[model samples]
Target: MSTLTPGEQAVMSRFDLGWPESDIAADLSISFARTRAIISTFDSNPAHDRHREAQIRRGSQRLLARLRKAGGHR
Candidate 1:
């Protein structure tokens, strides 16, 4: 159960992907202050943390599979 709005989710997703706040703000076309404010207020829910961890694991697995298929792995 996410309490964040769609825009917030997008911001957080990019943030999780290691994007800088400036980059996120520029990409999203939002003000830097707004981006900082949103990030500052990010809540730490255990469920959300677990969900994000699972998503990262799944993405890593898929990337590894694609690399293997493309002979990109050593």
Candidate 2:
């Protein structure tokens, strides 16, 4: 895959790190509405949607790893 932009990387990283959308928006200095709009645009395109799904899957894996490391759950 192509390298993501810094902003996209930040968004992906925040999501991968288990930050909520509101928190991500706050950290990125963006409004929640803008965040929602971005997500909507990502979802609306088939290719982008697939890419986002992969990102989410990767994020979920990272979250699971953190949980395991913390002995939180299975």
Each candidate: how many clashes? 0, 0
Put down candidate 2 lDDT per residue, 1-74, tens digits, no spaces: 56667876777677666688899899999888876655545333688788778999999999999999999975
Q: Candidate 2, which segments miss by more than 4 Å at Cα?
A: 37-74
> Residue 37 in model 2: shift from native, Å?
4.9
User: Relative to the true structure, how large is the alpha-carbon lDDT of every model?
Assistant: 0.85, 0.76
Predicted candidate 1 versus true structure: per-residue lDDT over 1-74, tens digit per residue: 54899889888888888899999999999999998777655736577678778988999999999999999989
- Deviation in Å, model 1, residue 43 alpha carbon: 5.4
Worst ten-residue run, lDDT, model 2?
36-45
Candidate 1, superposed: residue stretches over 4 Å from native: 43-74
TM-scores for all candidates: the values are 0.54, 0.45
Compare the candidates by lDDT and give the number of the best one: 1
